[model samples]
Target: MMRREATGEAAPRTPQAGAGPVPAPLVASAVLGGAALLVWPAVFNGYPLVFSDTGGFLHQTLGPLMLWDKPWIYGPLLHAFHWRVTLWAPLAAQALLVSHLLWLAQRALRGTAAPAAHLGLCAALAAASTAPFTVALLMPDLFAPAILLALFLLGPAREAMTGPEAWYLGTVATLGIAAHLAHLPLALALACMAFLLGLPRGRALRDGARTAAPLLAAIVLLLATNWAGHGRPALSPHGATFMLARLQADGPAAAVIRARCPEAGWYLCAFADRLPMDANDFLWASDSPVNRDAEGRARFLGGALIAPEAQAIVAATIAEHPLAVATAVLRNALRQLVTAGIGDTLGDDHLRTALRPRIAEGFPARERAAYDAARQPRGVLREAMMPLAPLHGAALLLSLPLLAAGGLRAWRAGDAVALTFLAMVLAGALANAVATGGLSGVFPRYQARIAWLLPAAAILLLMPRRRS
Candidate 1:
């Protein structure tokens, strides 16, 4: 093992002939223990956590309706694991995968894969970060951080991974990207960083393309699934509608509607008086300008029906007020970066009415009963998670200086792996904020899902370095 010291120099490389391969049983036990820690929130909750969008994803395969805003990938993923018998299967799978990735990262950063060290890292993150909560959730939110870790492994820590491990990470990255629309842009940004960071070392083209391979694969999967399900090769069938909702919430689209109303004659023009609303209201509220009908009944299809008009409105708004649009997007992204909280992830009061019926339809009696009795539905998980907010905030705040110091130290020591890992983490945070916050509305869950990585990176950076 080649150890890096405080000074900008490598200590003598030592051979470890006696340090043989770790026993398979020990590795399995460590990973299972880590997985348990990662999903502790779910275990404590008595059921896997779900969200309003979980129903939409479930319908991808379990129900007849094909959701316009959602892709078909994650729904089938849930069905594959749970077989409609238990939601716990998918949650456990996600936790195991996340735990394995964390273990791999720890090994790459610390140069050892001791079970105690791996479990300790997992325990610390479980205790202090939102990672356990994110893992427990049945939503694709867990994949956000999983994608970041996968990219870091495949990019900065590439040399440390075995051939099979690299393949597995790439597969994880591909699935993570396909799980949610926001992940595509996040993955692309990280891949671009991988290429740019490799330039000085003359591996720019290879590293960039390698890192981008999963993104390309995810795109193909998305297109194939969309076409199979909706006869559309588009990545997201009604993606423009979501963007329009976001733009309307931000005020630019409303301005366009108001200025062009009664003449430009888009459906939105009729609601120019109700110009701007919260993005969620614009998309989901029964009386929203977008979803309300002449009789005041909810017309959910209005969103899909207005998709073409939404695209036109979005284009016109961006063209007419480019500066306003840019400023609003920047503001939203900044807000998204800081609004990391576990509240939305646990709070199901608003979603219960709509989400419960889907749970009943999709799951067996036992599972449905569990869903109804879950802490989220009973309004206990939110209270249980309240104490974690300050701790998570403090962890994120402390990570700032620690990450900066770690990056500075790595730079001075010429630790390319450490430098690249830190850069990737920072870039991932920005990319995720821009992708989710700018495209969708600013939501705490969007940022909260990935916030754990900040502290994880700080801890990984502080780990003692070893040769790849």
Candidate 2:
């Protein structure tokens, strides 16, 4: 047992050893409630949620070789449940993760919230925020918020946790951090930001390192997994390329390429005239000469040729065009902060182009029918829910001030629990914007994926007190 600032007595850590199992009726209620929130996207989509990268993840499921574009560990987990084409297996697993996250949030607050209140908050998030969107979405996007929640459990709840609870938080932190490559940096940034912004002043730096322990473990896990799966004991090798694409988006990479290309022996020099303005199109679009040509690919091989050159260009360009670089990064981060990038994400037809052949050989026939009916390439689909995006945007905007106010209030009241919630959510959102937008490029999916945390934390702080 451990004491908090508000409660001098040791708090309940876990259930007593002799306590009976959770009530069946309570379990049923949770399932029913969870189903209500988790099924909204599937119901609306006419099938399970699918993103553009979902098929790539599906294709990489236990692939013979490792792919750095997507982290290695996530694919195997996705592959494990590929026996069903309906994807119910994976979706259920993800919903369970979300449930555990919500449970942790309530627990981190020392059971301040009642079950109904928790469910109500969940419903609000699903209806008016990005919570269900990422949960139902097939990508590892949900892990961003999951990591922050796990950090809360590890940080503020550090002393009070039972052995099993500690292990659970540690595991969640590791998986949530490792599941997505971008999350690795996001977790590191959040751990530091929370320690500085939320933790008590005594030995703050030391405590910050302790707060980041799980993230370190996750980094090691990713390296080990990549070694076992990809033959390289390292994080994703795509950082340099990602950085390159980012420079392209800002107009500096092109200048560097043109200035030093044929003379300096850089490969991108040949395609200097044809580079696309968009980072994504430059990297992934088939028509772009970068993807179409051999030299472009060769330049990026092991970052041996292109990575160093990209670094040099970025440095020199930053030296010459510091304002431009900062302006681009800030603009992209702001773009991610406000507008949700739904259109550029989410897969419907092109997924089938990559998925149908694979599933035909292995997927169950019944699932194939559902997949065809719901996901196969079609001529024209209806418009997006025009109101939902802005409604979510507005909800997020409202949460910004609420979190700010909550943080100040918590510090004044000496509420470590409340401060932890605020720190994790706010730091996660800011780090997400910087890492996802600044490192890669500003994409809607990046912001929308983690935007739910702000509102979730605000609701947790502002909810009416439950009856004792």
Candidate 3:
């Protein structure tokens, strides 16, 4: 075990082998109780929260149609859990995954595998951070943080984990990365960092390769699913369309269009006058060029239809205005770092239009009724969550200094565990910000989903070190 802190904190005594084993019922109860607390927001909201994008996930399997916008893995997972009976099943699954990972994280970090301590960690996170809110939502956003936690377990916390536990975390990390397109780069960045940090030791190469294995598997799984569903073996077929909107919102695409239009004869030149619109508006607005034909007629799957052009536009814009693109990306990433809030997760008003029809079409009558009666759809969840925004803000604000102190202490003490934990939390958050904010445009939920790790790391850092 690493050296304990010299703060006069007594080291916890290790349990004797094969002695005082926890009863089976107690372990089950601990997991259930912890999961329940982690998903309290859904219980409070009277339903699992839904997003405008939830319909896209549902469509992947429920519609049996390929969505150009995202990967197809989450759709089948949602189907397996819910089976169209109730959305609660999937929420429960998410909660359980989160709960177990938290248990593992607490056990690995503080060297205390007690159920009560695990529940306490969950309770603290549920009260002060965005864990419950993310878990409650039926979106893939929760997996972003889950992936980071899972990576930490497989990397820094690997020494403390048993074989089965390592496999479980590796599986969770793989699924989490495959669940979202943005997650791939985030995981790769962290895994690469781990490799770089481990350079001094011969085992570093082995450890880095082990950590990266899941990412490689996730890529294969993503491609296989995409091939099965869309007949195209690609990560995201319409990614360029989204990128074009982001660049358009950020100014580079507009500058390129204005400078190269007419003579360039790009399809977007028709709308050069409206080049730099909000990313969301560019993608979803009725009158937006991407959503309309040259004659101003509405088109289904218009984004996908224009993806080739979108890709060209994105490439040209990046090439033509490299400095502007970099500046915009940096600006967006910084904005996203501090933009963590429960903005639209609790609110249903903005999503009702696109979300309602999917529920009507994909679910049974009883499930539809449940959706209609949920606090989110009735505009109550956001109001109930309004007070929590400040709490989350304060928690994150306090975590910054704690993490800085912890990082400094870890560096001075040459503590690999503390350093790896700090690095994963901070780097994952920043990489997420850059991936989602810079490429997809800034949304609070993008960062909010992962921001809980800040407080989680801070709490773990403060705990006295003990042998596992």
- CA lDDT, every model vs. true structure: 0.82, 0.67, 0.81
- TM-score (all chains, Cα) for each model: 0.94, 0.86, 0.93
Reference-based TM-score, model 3: 0.93
Stretches of candidate 1 above 4 Å error? 1-20, 295-300
- Model 3 is weakest, by summed lDDT over 10 consecutive residues, at 11-20
TM-score-best of 1 and 3: 1
Clash pairs detected, candidate 1: none
RMSD of each: 3.0, 3.9, 3.4
lDDT for model 1, please: 0.82
- TM-score order of candidates, top first: 1, 3, 2
lDDT of 3 by residue, 65-159 (tens): 77777788888889999877888999999999888777667666656556676677778999999888899999999899899888877875676
Model 2 off-target regions past 4 Å? 1-28, 84-86, 110-113, 197-207, 294-324, 346-349, 375-384, 465-468
Instruction: Give candidate 2's whole-model lDDT.
Output: 0.67
Which candidate leads the pack in lDDT?
1
lDDT of 2 at 249: 70
